[model samples]
Target chain A: MSTNNEIEKLRESEERYRTMIEMACDAIFVVDAESGSVCEVNQSGLIMTGLAIEEIVGRPVWELFPEDERDRGRELFDTAVREERGRRTSMHFVRPDGGRVTLDVTTALMRLSGRKIVVQVCRDATERDEFERQQARLSQYYERLLDSLPVGLGIRAAINATPKIEFENQTLKRMFDTAACKGSGITWDACRADMDEQPRIAITDDGSYAEERRLANGQTFLYTISYVRDLLDQWCEVTIVQDFTRRRQLEDDLEQVNRTLEARVQERTRELEEKQTQLAQAEKMASLGSLVAGVAHEINTPLGALTSNNDLFIRAIVRLKKLLDTSEVTSDAAMKERFDRILDSIDEVTSVNKTAGERIKNIVNSLRSFARLDRSEKDRVDIRDGLESTLTLVSHELKNRVEVVRRYGDIPPINCFPNQINQVFMNLLVNASHAIKDKGVITIRTALEGGWVVVEISDTGSGIPKDVLPKIFDPGFTTKGSGVGTGLGLSIVHQIIQDHGGKILVTSKPGEGTTFRIELPAR
Target chain B: MTASSNTDAGRSGTIVIVDDEEMVLTSLRSFLTLETDYEVQSFLSAKEALQYIGANDIDVVMSDYLMPEMDGISFLAEVKKIRPEVPRIILTGYADKENAIKAINDVGLFQYIEKPWDNDDLLIILRNGMEKQRLMKKLQQKIEEINRAYGELEGLHKEIVKTFV
Candidate 1:
């Protein structure tokens, strides 16, 4: 009765072991240790090999493997048996349908029922291997992408309160000289210590900041550091370094070009202003030339008549002397009468010549004062003198149509360019003369007031119109007939007054008259 | 030449002077009357002088340029039409010298004298002009005598040809 009870318990325990083996996810095999053949296989083992129980059980374990993997399988089995220990290896099996599967096999030597056997546990490793290979390829591609960037990139992390260079791209290695940085561990703080000047860094609440640093090797760099979470979910700093030397140089070059262009434009403007002044001066000279010609003709007319009369006087005297020397004057009454007539003729000639001489002297004096050619430089001169000379110069134009009345006052001389002042007066006087149609009167008045010499020239003629008054001093503005006046005259007058530090004003009534008032500094 | 001898030698022709200035006319008349025996006639207007030249036999005509009635060149050109043999001289201001020189070529004038001229130069010019007038008259007389002699000779030749025929 005791032997039957023990046999029933043993069978029950064996059946339970068989059921557990069949329910396992991994394949299980029991091989004969001496023959190196598969003596038993679980349900998973058959499924893994794609073979039936008959095909797998009692077969050589090396034969269950592919042709190329049979040697490796046999070697694993032999090692397990000879060492009387367990062995782990990877092996491939070929199914009857020519399909392949990879497995991780762990073998152990055991004695069951006094027979030596190998227990093999195998798990399919194909999916895990493929996942590991894809992971490796992706890692390689990411590294290459970072290396190709223009800006140097680096990652730093504080592991256990100590900063470490987690990763650095190829560009960052080249920029920081990885060989030299090896001694310092290639941290940003270490690189700052190598610089000539330490830059100030300000980080915001976002844990990202940028700074410019000048290295001891004469390189300028911009560092942008950003704090980001890495793949391991740890915070790290990413630094992007850009060289700023070339950009700064280009900016400086552009500023210099701008400065040079402004200078050239200013020089060209100055040249154009000089040319305009020269043109106005040429116009003034041309008008003066014509006035000189008229003056020369005026002087020559009297000079010719006086010279001829003087010659006749000399001849009459010579004849009278001849008669006296011959002693024929006392003897003949006719000769005495002829002598008296000759003396009378001489007297007449003397009187006419004296008038002509005075006329010549006045004309020459007026011309000299009008031009003031020798006194072009600034001098202390009476404004009245300039006015008087200018009046004389334009007297021919004013002779028939315009009458001039002078109201002189006791005024002091002023410091000025006398020639230029005279020119201004001449232009005004001529313009005043031209304003009249048939007959009119011009009044000139001078006075001294508050350290200024004031001159007023008024004409009773056709005055300037209201519409044309504002533009009278603009260059190339004219009211006179085309052949009669140059438009630059009044503009030149205004310029000359400004140069002398003087002021000019005008008032006009279209039909009644026009008046020009000038105030010059008395210095 | 001695003044007396020069006056005696030039005692023949008539010199007519025209100018707008009375002073110029007076001065010229006095000088001509005192220095030479020739008749000196002066006029303030070129028109009156032109009329005088047409009516009388004048030796020389002197005019002033820049006159109001007629310019010296135009007056002289008129004188040329009436009495083409008359030697015409122009007295001009210095400023008008260029125009006077141009007119000299245009009008076939004797000479142009600038204003304020030397008295000696004037005398020389006047003397040469009168001498030209005298020579021209002498040539005209000689030509007239030759014509009279030729006419007589032609008449003699005709008589001899009649006798021979």
Candidate 2:
């Protein structure tokens, strides 16, 4: 009975220790210094070291460490066992996969029922180590993204009625003439863009664009600012700055081109209007002149006979009066003394009638010639004749105000429509006469230029202002204030010459005088 | 030059003047009395002159154009109807080319004159004008008298008609 009880108890103790070892998830082992071996290991030890109990039953515990760390590990284990002091150490734990696990090992001396041994407990730390490394990598990635962005970015706080820069990127710090972003910060509106007061750009905030402005220094930058509610829903502004000076210069050039186009359109409109009015005026004046000429020719034919009859009638009456006077003064004294008076009266009446008739003939001849203008109508005639006729027609208006200094060139009849050409001359002469608001000299000259017939008229009148010179030919553009300017006189002159394929030039100086030069295509 | 030379020929004539305007009439009367030798008879309108033409001896006729009812062209046409041999002259202030051509071709008017005429030219034209009128009237009168003298020829024609019948 004693033998049976003793055997049973031994078996139970062994079973209890084995159960403890199997349930533990860490490696459990025993090191025997005298044998230089591991006496036992737990389930985790078997799986971690990739060995079965038979494969490692007596192997040296130091072998679990790499060759480089084995001696140090062994010394540590020996000190912990001899001193009866527990110790913890980390060691390289090799695995079946040919990789390694780091082991956090605990060792202490312990006595089993009949033996003394050192116990080591190792926990695998690889999983915790990997988790920590992953966290470190994530942090580094975030830092790099923040530092490398190109836009000059700045974060500012909106407080105290101004923006205060809280943070600025490297680029933002370099701009704004500051080592750090300062100045209660800059508002979206206050900050200049392209170095201008209004900077236009695309932004993420509610307002996407701003206008471009120029700064006094001439340096340029474009800034865009966005205001957002962050995670805490606090208002914050992010400003982005870019330089757009070159684009603004291009826009300015584009504006200048638009202005030039507008000016050209206006000029073309004026020129066309002038042409239309001039053509109408030319048609009217020509028809009127022709009608007058025809009338004068018809009158000349009949006046020729009527005056001759009048001459004969006057002679007959005079002869009759002379016969009566002879009878009144007869030598017979029987005649009354009053007969002398009657005879005197009859002679006086005849003489008066004769003189008056002669005067009537002169008035009629002048009127007929005035209409005929034959001297002007006939080619190769003297220009003086046309000028005189024009003077006669407008003589009532001229009287004393205008002093005409006509420097008549040997104006050969270069091929021309005499009546029509005379009209041009008349209009210019009249305009020169009218130009003088007061008394002034009008110099009219005509001559032959090379391959061209030139007519020049000058007036010592109120000259066109310098700025008005370019606009003189423009219809409805005149210096004769208010309703004074028909404004079409010079414009008509300009077109008539042009219709003749001639060129007209005007030279004027303010307060000095004006000269009109005409070049006609010579026939 | 041709016109002046032709007009210088005659030294004496009885000239009849016609016009509406008193100034023209008086001045013309005085001018003829002073400047040329001719017996003067003056009337304002063609109606007044028509009476003189029948009874009074007149050497020439000169009329103004554009009278209210009787224009110079129409008056000359009427005178031609009365005596085709009459030398009539028309005076006008207007060109009136259409009317002038009408007068010359249709009425056989002697002349078309525009106003404001030369004095010497007028006298020369009248001298020629008077001679033309005298010759036309004498020839016309002789033809009439010959026709009157030859009326028995028509009686002879009636006798011949009865014989033919």
Candidate 3:
């Protein structure tokens, strides 16, 4: 009964071994260790080589491999048999259809039926090898792409606890001192030490964050960081840094240039405005001068004729008297009496004519001088002369309407353009006369004050309005009705005075009087 | 008139006055005739005056400046070309000193008189011009008489050379 039990146990053990081998995912085969011949193959082994059991069972193991791999296969088999343990290797096999199968093979010495035997279990490692190679190639491609970026790129994992740097390109490594930046906590320390100011970034639930930092080397950078998961599904951060120093400097320089250009343009505009005002004033003065010259020319001719005729009449009367004294006409009382009467009458008429003619001549002369037709040259002129000439020219307007008062002092002649100075006097006198309504006093006072010659023209007429006084010297500013005054008179006067290195001032009270004070340098 | 007529009529010299204005012309003519021993002739245009002067023995030529057709300086220059020995005077209403100096230097003007001139002053200028012309004529006549005498002497010497040598 014990012998029967032992036999049954042996049978059951054999069946279990057969079932395990047939259902295994790997291919299992047995070969003769000395001859390197295949003894038996399981179902999976036959399927792996795409062969029948008969075709593999009695074939040499070297025949399954290519000619090149036969020697290596024999060596593995010899080694396994000597050691009495299995040895693993990987090799390619050729099937009957001329296709290739890559196998993970193992060889061992087994004592089955008291014969030297070899067993091999081969798993199809082609798929797993292909997956590992693809992964390696993809990683290399991403490394090259990151290297090609203009900005520095780096990858880090677990920034808080036991921080680790997984990957870093050449640029990031170079910027952070390769050895120091290889890890996480050290990289943060390097970043802090390199920045001039504290980096500005706010960390929230991770997506992306940016920091602008200035380095101690006077270089600026913007760091853009993105949270990502690597192929292994581990959380990491990607940092993209861009240099911003040069661009910031360029922007600052542009702003400074814009400000300078704007200031220059405003200054040039002010100069142009001043020149335009001076041009308008010059035009007004030129036209007035021409008109005065024309009037003076017209009046001087007739006056010359009248004065000459009067002179002739006087000469004739003198001749008649001489004849009466030297000739025999003295014997005739009637003739003598007639000649004396004629002489007396001629004398009275000649006196009156001479006085009137001189007055007209003086006015005409004053107009001519005031016109200043040839005003290219300046002369040493008495200020009083200019004032008197201007007064004489405007005498017609001021005759009965205004009383003239003169307070002339002993002041030296000033070196000046007489025409311009005379123009100033004329404008002041005319303005004063116009201010008078019905018989008011116009006082012209001149004196030497310090290093200046001062002329004060005052009028007791309707004074300038308080609000209008400040702008009286401004071009085109006038309170007079349109077409009555050009409004450039006082402006021209002010310009002329300024051009001569002088000053003009006005003091006026409404309904009281107005005084124009002109100060000219004495020299 | 009486003073002028009392002087020797035959000795009185002739004068020419050129003026554009009729009144100025009449006044000058009357004044010259009444105040001086000169027979006066007047013309309204410079061309007429030049034509008359070309045919007359004028002692003094007085012309007004600023006239139509010709100015006083140019008229005087023309008279100088016709009778360079005649004295010229310019009368102008517009007494521009530059024009007067120009007339004096270029036309050899004897006088620049401003019009409506003083009668006595103008009379003095006219008298001086006539006196200079008279003195020049007298000197010229004396030179002619001497030339005549020398010609006669030359004729006599030639005759003697022909007869004795």
In order of appearance, the predictions have TM-scores of: 0.48, 0.46, 0.63
Candidate closer to the true structure by lDDT (higher is better), 1 or 3: 1
Best candidate, lDDT-wise? Answer: 1
How do the residues A1-523 of candidate 2 rate in per-residue lDDT, one tens digit apiece?
8778878988887889789887899898877756658998888989888888988779878777779889977887888767887898878877789888888888888777666688888889798678768778876665455546765677777645766776666655455554222443533334453243443445445684543445544445566666777667778877676545566667777899989999999989877777679667756655564666565645444444454554555455555545655674554554534555665676676567657655555544444344443333335544456556565665556678888787877655555445555566676777677778888888888787787777788988778778878877756666668898777766776666776778999898766688988887666
- The deviation in Å at residue A453 for candidate 1 is 38
Ranking by DockQ: 3, 1, 2
Better of 2 and 3 by DockQ: 3
TM-score of chain B of 1: 0.93
Worst 10 residues of 2 chain A by lDDT: A179-188
Give the per-residue lDDT of model 1 (tens digit) for B19-138. Answer: 888877787777767767778899999999999999999999999887998988899999999999999999875353445578898999998886656667887898899999999989
Docking class of 1: acceptable
Q: Model 2 misses residue B122 by how many Å?
A: 1.9
The C-alpha stretches of model 1 lying farther than 4 A from their native spots are A1-43, A54-125, A142-227, A235-250, A294-523, B1-165
- For model 2, the superposed segments whose C-alpha errors exceed 4 Å read A1-384, A414-419, A437-439, B1-23, B33-59, B95-109, B135-165
Expressed as tens digits, the lDDT of each residue in B1-165 for candidate 3 is 245443743336888988877777777776666666678999889999999999988898998877869988899999999999999998875534454686689998888876546666877787788888999999999999999999999999999999999
lDDT for A40 in candidate 3 is: 77
Compute the lDDT of residue A113 as modeled in candidate 1.
81
Q: Share of real contacts kept by model 2?
A: 0.43
